[model samples]
Target chain A: MAKRLQRASETVFAPEDPEFQIAPMVDVLLVILLFFVSITSAETIKARPQSLRVLELPVAKDSKKKETSAGEVVINAGWEDGSGMLEVAEVSTSKFADPDRMRQFLRDAVKADPSLRALIRADRKVEYGFINQIMLVCTQEGISNITFAVVDKERQG
Target chain B: MAGGGGGGGEEGDYGFQIAPMVDIMFVLILFFMTAAMMKVSENELGIKAAGTPTASQEAQPAEIQLRIDADGTVSFNDRVIGSPIDDSLAALRSRLKEAIDLFGEKQPVVIIPQSTVKHERVIEVLNACAAANVKNLTFGGGS
Candidate 1:
């Protein structure tokens, strides 16, 4: 029966030499390229310069004000001297120079006040590396209570 | 599957494989590479210390968690304690002076900073610690 049908449809034609064309593939690729470019470029949020403002913290009512007799520790930033020394009260402290001395001073402060917390105020120009140094001292001395002082943006222009 | 690109001499087959498939593969590879690079660069915390360490002096290990934002704000644990940055350096100094006295022993304080946090801010924190005479420093990655 199949042979009879084939003989009856002898007028039908098919391509004897067919090959793949590169043009169609190129068209498909162009579509994909356009899709990607449009999607990636459509994103609007680019990383921008961060503006950091340091604010002031409220004073604790129960915390007592203890006077320092071993002189002051100065942790001043943005000084022209380039020395990252903090003045404790009025005395210049150089505990930053040596890790051991710094640790000793921290230990002493903790001994003086069992409920002691450190409040660090950094200048706008001071880098993170400098801040890490202070964190190191706190962790080493076991002074867990820490606070940062920032200026209110509304007040600082 | 093969032919052409040989000065049209070796084989009489002009019907060579299409180069479009190769171009698509290259594009896909490029896309994946970019995505991977972005992920790695997102949390680039300059943590000098990673693991945990026991201090020589403290019998009980104390945890000192330092929080650093992009601005110059530093927080220990969750509390925000301090005065205005410029004038309050002394106030900070006095606070640390007291804290150091309370700890009374050597313990490792861990500094965990954020990825986008600035370098100068970290330095100021360290300077404040030094002013308080607290030492023994270690670093960890930021949140």
Candidate 2:
């Protein structure tokens, strides 16, 4: 009985049997790495620059799923806190200011890449007139491919 | 027994440490997590900004006029369809579907929104058109 007890103690106290196996840990780490990499890549297309102001986009239940192409130009329209003018792509344009410069910029961009699409990211609180004005400018610049950026209703929560 | 055990230990055994590998994996995991969290998903609704078709051009498809007032009221062809309080915009959807059925998918939809109308209300009208499978959408000044 004593010999059996000694053998059992030796088996219990064996140092070679590690508490954690490296193989399973490695497998888990690899799976996590793959998951994160895929998720990051999937969301990278919509990532906006930090310098751009955050606009509360309107929610649309039937908004189509579209990938913004490489040459697409994104225009952000929102109200500036201090100035009562509409902010279009970081430029402040009041109701009186002629949008000739903005239109010229868009014309030059479209001239360079005719296939370039225009995306308008308008704030939810913004008036519809502001968006219409921008759309008119795009049409005048010969850019027919215009899109409005919005948030999916399901994702709003 | 000691000599035999010593000889056994000398057999084809190369020591490989796993601690450093685990540390490196942890660093990689941290980096990936940070990158994933920083990315955000952006969605878009396609709209074509083109001038009104002139009479010189080919026969244009039937055009449906939609209007939104500042108080979130939606109207179809000068007839008020739904109010802002209706979250689903059921009436607007049904009317737009009827228009789509009559004019087919090639029907042109022109949205005339008041200058004071909220952006959300405008999107609601656009969503109704999208649900009805109306592709050719145009934005026009208040009528």
Candidate 3:
């Protein structure tokens, strides 16, 4: 038995064959490549709730682009003493008081245009609770594109 | 069989070994397990999208946009609530309940946030909405 095992070991070298692993390596490489591709593809499509506010960047008006996009809802927010107030403004009119009313206004605005994005221009001192309400309203309206008007960090700094 | 020393072996004898594949699978399992452990520390809410994509045209009912600024003042839609964030929160609950009743339970409710708002204020709104039984929730960046 010892002599037979020694002879077998001499003849049967595990790494001797060049094509021994070609098929398996190719299969594994393909699988790994597929895994990475799927992971990155899914990431780009994944959406998340936004917390950062965007300030409008000035641009030259393009008539063709204006017709396709809806109008914007701008809120100029401020704080009084410890209380908070936001003035809802548009090209035509401005209304103040009652957060719920503003929520309704947002709903109406969204209904009218369906594609309009809400732009909140809030004072630095405004409280966090009011911000939450704005977010809640946006979620309710299904308005996904929300931008915050901010001073450029680089420019401001 | 080819004209080689082992060509005399049976044609049906060739088979691939699974031991290396098993090792690779074990490595993958370990990688995922370690990665999953890292995820447990993060807030799950922070990961969820508040609404549809920017171009989505889905119809939505009247929603309350609650803004909580850096100072903790609360607003619904764009209107600022009375002082003491709690009052605004209570008012928000009542209004939300009324809207839910009028628009039906499935209507979406969104929270638009500013950059400097306190994290605690956001949680307070979430708690208030949950308490009021408003299930449809979303968040977006706001001024």
Candidate 2 lDDT, B37-128, residue by residue in tens = 65445677787775745455656666778888888887788898878787678887888788788878677889888987877788878888
C-alpha lDDT (0 to 100) for residue B14 of candidate 2: 46
Residue A134, model 3: Cα distance from true site in angstroms? 1.3
The digit string of per-residue lDDT tens for model 3 on A3-68 reads: 999889988965575565646755775576556545444322111112222222221111011211
Clashing pairs in 2: none
Q: lDDT tens string, model 1, A1-157?
A: 9998887677465445677676776677667666655655543331211222221222221222333313223233332234343323222332233334456667787787755555554454444455556656765676654544332221222
- In terms of lDDT, the poorest run of 10 residues in model 3 chain A is A59-68
Candidate achieving the largest DockQ: 2
What proportion of true contacts does candidate 3 retain?
A: 0.11
CAPRI quality band, candidate 2: acceptable
Model 2 chain B poorest ten-residue lDDT run: B1-10
Candidate 2: residue B129 Cα off by (Å): 1.4
Q: Using lDDT as the measure, which candidate wins?
A: 2
Docking level of model 3 = incorrect
lDDT-superior candidate, 1 or 3: 3
RMSD, one per candidate, in order? 20.2, 9.1, 15.8
lDDT of each residue in B6-111, candidate 3, tens digit only: 2223766755545555556657645654544332111112112364654556777766777766566777777876244463377777777787778775667777
